[model samples]
Target: MPRPLWAGAISFGLVTIPVKIVSATEDHDVHFHRVHLADMGRVRTRKVCELDGEVVPQDESGKGYEIAKDQTVPVTDEELEKMPLPTAKAIEIAAFVDADTIDAVRISDSHYLAADGQVAAKPYTLLRKALERSSKVAVAKFAWHGRERLGLLRIREGAIVLHSMKWPDEVRDPQGLAPKVVEVGEEEIEQGLQLADRMTIENLSGFRAEYREVLEDIIAAKADGKPLPSPDEGGERKSGEVVDLMAALNASVKAAKESRGEDHGEEATVHEMRPAKRTGGRTAPAKKKTASSKTAAAKKTTARSTLAAKKRAGTKTAAKKRSAS
Candidate 1:
């Protein structure tokens, strides 16, 4: 087990469980240190005062909120600490509700929670057992880093688990992103649902950590001084704009079945809007990749016909290529 980064006592109604919060997740994102442009040397940043041009002392600095362009509101650590303290420090138990009631978007990250020592073993096991037997999550609140966070504590695989949650207002309504969720035809939605059901993979073997793999490849390629991959229409090395939504979806379904080995035959989506004719009048097949290729083999794919989609495609291409080897 990794060393615990934080040690604290979980507090609730009357029970205090001594526990340690360990670094639960490890991020493998490829990162590069900042470097001087001309010399290509590492660039280190420090907290230097603009007026004195010297590193500032931690005790001399404080956090401030900007009220206006030049106005500010100052808060002291002592005053901030007096506001409120969450009763339960260790995994607190509140009321448990049906898991289906909570939307998945509300969850952020999950962490494994374990008792500190042999002393907490019995109670921890009992709590986990109760939660598992009832098949309900404890909707509890925890004060983390001065902010009170809504979290759900549950039992998974005989162990306690926690999922941090977002506030109700944090999630945006879907109505603003499109015309109207109600305006969508029932048949079209059903078709989409069916398509999704068919496309969902039941086996883990079918899934790939392509993003991680691609990033690693690119890093190796760059270290070896290999040429960067080109940005072609993401496929067939040809570029064209999509004109219709429903048509594109239909075309994709057909193309997938024809070339991508799509199984489970999906139901076709029916949309009111149709795609416009290809403006550039180009027909190009994506470049084929060989085993000796230094760049990513699969092309970036997107169905969104907006600028965001284009930017995302570019990002995916770059990241994929960088990690690809």
Candidate 2:
């Protein structure tokens, strides 16, 4: 097993359990290093003092808080270590609340809480079982690294997991960017819901990041001294003003059904009233056909007119020849 990142005791009322925290997730993103174009040498950075033109060693450097425009107050590591915090070596449960009450956006990072030793295993199991039975999460506070953090403790997959939470102020206010209230018809709302239902999936395991895969392939090709692949030009999409909302929703539902190998016998009837089209300033009126569709209809009409003219000329020629005979 991998070594735990932190060792601490979890306390609640009169119960205490010695537990170790381990990271519950990992990053699989591809990383690159900066190199010189001429010699391919790895580029390195150094910390230098801004006030004095001198290279600062890692050991000599310490954290500081800027108090003024150009002045900062230096804080020593020893002083930070001596600061009083209840969670430095222990996680104290402050409250127990329904798990669903916590907003998913507030949850930040996750870690697994495991029993530190065999002596603590019983209490750890009891706490996990109790949390599972109550269907609630324990809100706890702890200090990790240099800052104190608020977290939630809950049972997951037969193990206790701790999730760090962001403060209420940390979440940005979305009101400024949110869309204004707009009227929507019942049929449009129903069709929109149907479209969403068609696209819903029970498991997200099948979804993979194709962009990352392509990036990795490009890197591999470069390493092997092979020719680079061209980037893909994705299909174009129509603007909201030109797009028939009901038609598009119906098409999406049909496509999704076809992708799942389900037989969609007949297309759903699109109601006349469409969902509001969002332009910059106001909702634009919906059109019967898009520009491309209008162009196609004009071409078809011209073709039919030309065909009718040719048929009339052929009949007139035949009549003239018969009269001459």
Q: How big is the positional error of residue 59 in model 2, measured in Å on the Cα after superposition?
A: 0.4
Q: Per-prediction TM-score, please?
A: 0.66, 0.77
Query: Per-residue lDDT for 16-128 in model 1, tens only?
Result: 66666655576645456899999999998789987789998889888778999878899887756676565334456566798779889999877767689988787777777
Model 1: runs farther than 4 Å from truth? Answer: 9-16, 50-53, 65-84, 181-191, 203-206, 227-250, 255-325
For model 2 the local lDDT of residue 252 reads 76
Cα lDDT over the full model 1:
0.62
lDDT of 1 at 277: 24
